[model samples]
Target: MSLAPILNPAQSGRAGVPCSVVGASCLLAAASLLAPAIAADTVRDRDKAAIRAAAQAYQEALSRGDGPALAAFWTADGDIVDEQGNTLAGRKSAADATKPAAGTVRPDMRIRETNLRFLTDDVAIEDGTVEVGLPGIAQPVRGRFSATWVRGADGWKLAALREDRLDAPSDAETLQDLDWMVGEWTVVEDREGRPEAAAGDKPAMEITVRWNANRTFLLRDMKIPAAAADEANQAGTLNVTQRIGWDPLSRKIRSWVFSSDGGHGEAAWSRDGDAWVARTAAVLPDGTQTSSLNIYSFDGKDRCIWRSLPTHVGGEHAPAFTMVMTRKPKGKTP
Candidate 1:
């Protein structure tokens, strides 16, 4: 019987072969050619899933600066070649990398653009870039890497890692986000049209912001008219000078603030959506420590809102205050 009717029973109603022998042979040959071949040398599907799990764990450990945990991701004799041509092997390979070197702050490694291929059932190769979020250095560094991952009795482990090139982006470009803050601003009514300068809450504030000569720092001078909010402002018109700049060592935008009444503090600035939040850690003239969250958000080019939410002040909870700030008219003096 011709194989055509047997293979494709609906081709003809007759049970016996209805096609010619040559046609049956051609159909059989075509079906054979379309058959999938399972290669023994290729990676198993389960193994690929395991490798992905290990990669995720690897990134998590590296970010938290957990040295011992990072070391566990590698094989017993695994090694790494850094961008500088230095080689480290075994536990030292993972442990040493997590240690923040000089000029680096919290060098967190994140693998990106990963391409994984199986060399064999038990071995895989991965090519990607490792972006290190090292805050203290001025330049942002990205290192291209090729890693060898091997499936072992326990699980997948990194057998070798090589970082060949390092690319860096200019640090100044990162500071451009704050350019909108460089202007003179004075207090306005709150966002809800409520006055923030209520009794015993906050004084009226006017701030003039300008860029330093190098354009690397923001110079802000604030004048507060004497009010009942604090003893310092009640004595006279309080002047507060603050210099905000990018600190390469800390990998943060840092500000140093000094008040006319001898109160001084520093804050690390970070972005939260459309707002900039500064967590200030300050000490009063009488040696009392205080901390507050200062949030600055914008409505447009000419107006913004500032909120001082107190977390701690002399071991008591002080009321949080909010105010709207309008940009002063050009060439106008207060």
Candidate 2:
């Protein structure tokens, strides 16, 4: 995301009046008019940074099980609202609630700032995502948090904090469940033959999955080399990109796919027992609509199986097919 430059109103003048004239009284007036706004902006930026640092410090304290240190980041009268909608008033109460039990391991926590809105130079509202990983839990617990920050002699301090546990799984948690698939994988064997292979085309397929820089989305890319002359003259080959993320509006795990062959798809994913399923609908270049249910099962970290049940295509149903995928050997090139 690119931000537009913050223009100085003093230098830009007001109401189309020119302030560049030599010894112009209008220039002084413009400068006077803009001084408070400029100062406020500067203070807001500085406070935002301070509040973020304070949040990070609190996270560290939590990781280390330092209840006192966590309390130090808050104002003397700061309060906290826990996920269960219970309020712990006063910094001491908040600190006591954060303290880990004796001989217990502290949960690892990571915070990502999402928004900061300044109501005044001395106060601001902060929103962030919190990910917590506890011992014996397969996946981290994801939640959202909001805090009211105040500027005092010690700089920004959390005056009030509220945490809410998500009733539905977050995109990060959903993606993390599939993190085992983050690697290069190849189709080692196909119990059912590929569609192109049945047409006497020995096409090759490769798949790679990785996380975006912020680990907010899983990006999967697949490529199949053309095995026929007619297909070669078209798009370089069969290339598809899939992005898996949490859809806030749908409140579900969703994916969008785009292909070089002018095909695109949208899928809503769900978990069934040990397998993950994606119900997908795609539109082809020729305006044909196709729908399929794809089931993905994991054998282990290195092996998985995929089954595609084509339920509808141009008003016709197709048989289901399955394929096995094995993680590419480490240090091996394709």
Q: What are the models' TM-scores?
A: 0.45, 0.43
Candidate 2, residue 110: how far the Cα is off, in Å: 46
lDDT of 1 by residue, 1-334 (tens): 5666455646644346554554777888887766543333243666777888888887776555556877788888887655434355645535533332333223345667888889887899988876544322333345687889988888888888776545432354346678888888877535333544432445378889999999998999999877633864357888899999888975668889999889998876766556776757666687655555577877658877777653210111233556777887888887
Q: Specify the poorest-scoring 10-residue window by lDDT in model 2.
A: 310-319
Cα lDDT, model 2, residue 220: 96
Report the lDDT tens digits of candidate 2 across residue range 162-272.
776554543444667878879987753343444333333242468899999999889999876665213735556678899998777776788999988888988877665
Model 1 earns a TM-score of: 0.45
Give the runs in model 1 whose Cα sits over 4 Å from its true position: 1-173, 189-203, 228-233, 312-316
Query: Candidate 1 at 193: error in angstroms?
Result: 5.6
